[model samples]
Target: MEVKLHDIGEGMTEGDIISYLVKEGDRVSVDQPLVEVQTEKMVAELTSPANGTVKEILIDVGKTITVGTTILTIASEQGADPAPAKEETAATVAPAAPSQKSMIMERPKGAPLSNRVKAAPYTRKVAREHDVDITLVEGTGRAGRITVEDVLRYVEERDNGKTKAAAAPEKTPSVEKEPVHQPEEEFDTIPFKGRRKQIAMKMSQSLFTIPHVCHYEEIDMTELLDFRKELKAMDENISVAAFFIKALAIALKEYPVFNAKLDEENEVIRLEKSVHMGIAADAEEGLIVPVVRDADKKSLRAIHQEMKELTQKAKENKLTVKEITGSTFTISNVGPMGSIGATPIINYPETGLMAFHKTKKMPVVNEHDEIVIRSMMNVTMTFDHRVADGGTAIAFTNRFKSLIENPKKLMLELV
Candidate 1:
């Protein structure tokens, strides 16, 4: 059976082969990861569909191939003789001396061959911008492939003179000190591919297609903080973001327009039956939002657990297609990163996005007219003006704010 590259969802048409987990002649189980492919949104592990013995690998690592292309040939039965490796063709003899370019291309004695340098196209680009020879930098990825981090680490070491000292350096001509000022100007160029490209496209579309209206509110989280501490004492590791998600879910129920999607072609507002909350998590590749399905139906602890699992999977580049899609509403919490506030763009197809910043202690007048120190947090909501009016947006944010500010009321409703 031929193991073709199947669609990994999100309308992805192609993927770059990151690395192969199994080699020819290796037996694989059904659903076992066969290879890691870098798609537009994430690096996903393409799995074997059936139990089989790997026969032939059609695609090489770092090669971008279209979907439905056969990547591997597998024998359905075991003990099949593996196909022989392709023979290399004899090199044609060239006349006399090599050209200037060919001479410069020669690897240093004892250095790794350029053709053997295992690096992604983006990693190679970074190497070029820094003038760092990738063949000299050791690869740290699977199968000794060079990753972005490895290239960056090499650049750092070279800049710090650690790696340079280990290798022979080119001689520089001595010049007398004459107050010559040469400021060092350096920058890295990151190729917009994979997840970063997807993020850029979606963000641009959301900003242009949706008429956005932002509503800002500040909530006192002192009570919420106390409640979290109490929960923590009980060994419940629920976070403040979970509480905010719950409050947003409740508010969405009250204001259905905010929980709806706009069908511009049909000119209709489709209210979602269930609240699926997307948590915008910053992963290594880029920003990815993994959704929590039926968030309104789950308890705060359940939500927290799911959030942790999804976040971990996202960061580890293990998120499934179902986990990263289908959110009616999304929340981006920059609070942990020490951001005070942010006007986040709406996640495309979703009508609203909620952004919250770091909580800080400040003096505020209490209901009893006494000035008291309290933990305050800023919350911003960016909504589609087409799907919801300004009044509806304001009401929704106010309801959300009210729930967050009154922790007891919010907890009682949960009960």
Candidate 2:
């Protein structure tokens, strides 16, 4: 029978063939990883449907195939020889390695956190980092469960407090003052699943796939700060992030490649016609970037509304699959979190990303000797070196900074 492959998720109608693990004429058993697919969400491994010999392999690597596409053909050996089939039935199949289940766990669909194991997420994390086997630890909590204290105790006893005590020669570090035991109660740890997993994968892909060039510049935002205050006084709901988004859209009109993506396979560069801007939101999970499509045409109120809606959707886990994909460019703002400046990872496929940090009032000396306190914010723009040079990237950032500092320039009289 022909083995037809179907999309494993709702929004995924097709996927780019990452690679085929098994080749034609290769013997394969049931449930072995046969192929891998790159969908919008995550890399999914397609396993063998039955115990059979590979007859034919269809489709090439990097080809985008749709649902119900024939990935490969497998010929069942059972009916070929009745004696072999009977022998196979009587043969005992050794159980899979016991360590497999510990490495992989089922994540509940939709809700990323519901179906995970009972241990605190951070405790599991600590064990993994220290190379301590979590399965071996005894539990003192209810239901014979492992707790954070249990994991910490394991670490302390295993290391004999050598590293912790070595850090300070004055006295043995008080167990009461163990640094890792900080006020974790302040934050709820959300499972890194769904969009969060996609975010992490993309971030790592960006770092590994592209050569990044981070160009930094400090801009005087005195006028912009006053203008922002004026706008806020007129309407308190107007956000600085919205203003930054608008300024970024204006700058993209001047520097196009900063809003471009590399089509490496086809040796083509794609400059997006419409600016779909993304605002980074750090929710209970990790950072999520939800795009605002056709942002150049949206009014300030429209921008604010879209941003508010996306933020709400991100927090409530109500964002549709489409909301997480497709972006010409992205921006990460940590001003709300009080971060001054940070070098951010570019969201992959997008050639560039800009990060906005907290604005601080600092004393500055003008072209004249007059010293005055001016409001300034640090802007760090990271670009893919393969697409844009340092000069082009810097020019893009400076233009963006100018629009932000003037604010009225972004509000040009005639649209």
Candidate 3:
């Protein structure tokens, strides 16, 4: 039987073979990962269709091939195995078939006694680690909910041997035999594809291939906040986040080393002139980093317009291939998520990434020794230590700090 490579979606015409999880002649089971393919935007794994001996892998790494192309051949005994199922093309999953009016959606079975426990994903993961029947753990959350913390506490108790059965002095005999049941929560599982897959591959590569160093700086954004307020009053659509990107662009101009790319093949660093900045936007589907070309040369309005258009297009799933490619530096701002700080992974080929975190109102003393409530944001930059030094990263951050603290300086730079 031949296994054809089907498009998994995200507008990819072809995929570059990343690596094969299985080899020719290896017996594989259904749902087993067979190979990983890298599209320009992300990576995706193709799984085996049936239990069969691999006959051949027609595709090789770094080779780009079109969709519906036959990439592998497998040998299966007739009537011995069911035909492995293939996923429908990268388009949306076909909607569920209409059920008869009399049909009832039967929930999946869980804990022995009750059919109504709901747990979060993290909580379920924690329960599995502790070997605890989640359905049996009494939920303290609203409407009988199980939180991640609840599961963690249960694990800690078990680790401490604090169970009544373990610490009790009197032994009791079992009276009646009954099945122990736990309630299971309903969850929608999303497959990793497109940008999610690219993030994973780039993270793995950065961890293994590059020696990375992260430096942290807490920026006093009191001035920046005031500037943002003024800007918002003037034009509400221009986000403070876009201003942050402008700051980063100016910073790159001064610290060119931080903007350079690591040539892994040549073991050298190459500094380029054009500053293409990647703004990481969280869309309903996944994380997309759309680049702003020549950001330093463009006016604040142009940058804001481009960022807005790119983000909107990204959300609408209408970004062209050209819009998402060729970024020199990347910024992932999770401030909207309320994260205080994070050391983000460097997007490969590019040596640095800056993660902007939530701003908080904190008490601070100025040089005048006066206590004041000020807005503070933490900016963390992760760089490939092989190419850039601590001084380079710090300088880049300092320039960013200056631009953000004084937004008017950006207009001057633009002219």
Candidate 1 lDDT (Cα, whole model)? 0.81
lDDT of 3 by residue, 1-415 (tens): 7776675643334556778898887988888888887664545678888777888777776565556667787777453434455534324445545572223245334333344466554356557756888976767754556755576566677778776556668868978879888899899997554456445544654565568899999888877677767877887556777788777877888888878897756877899798899888887656678889988788777888898899888788677657887789998889889999877878766889999898999999989999999988988999989888998788888888877877677667764
Candidate 1 lDDT, tens digit per residue, 1-415?
Answer: 7777777765455678889999998989999999988876677888887787888898899777667767887787654545544323224323435674576477566476445666666567667867878888878765567765677788788778876557767879987688979898898898666677657646755765688888888988888889888888988878888888999999999898888998766978899999999999998889988999999999998999999999999889888889987899999999889999777899888999999998999999989999999999988889998888788888888888888888889987783
Ranking of models by TM-score: 1, 3, 2
Q: Pick the candidate with the highest TM-score.
A: 1
Cα error, candidate 2, residue 396 (Å): 0.8
Candidate 1 residue-wise lDDT at 204: 55
Cα TM-score of candidate 3: 0.57
Question: Which stretches in model 3 have alpha-carbon errors above 4 Å?
Answer: 1-195, 235-237
Model 2: pairs clashing at backbone N, Cα or C within 3 Å: none
Q: Of the pair 2 and 3, which is ahead by lDDT?
A: 3
> lDDT score, residue 297, model 2?
79
The stretch of ten residues in a row with the least summed lDDT in candidate 3 is 100-109
Number of clashing pairs per prediction, in order: 0, 0, 12
Question: What TM-score does candidate 2 reach?
Answer: 0.57
Q: What's the lDDT of the predicted structure labeled candidate 2?
A: 0.73
Give stretches of model 1 more than 4 Å off: 1-4, 22-33, 48-58, 66-187, 233-237, 367-369
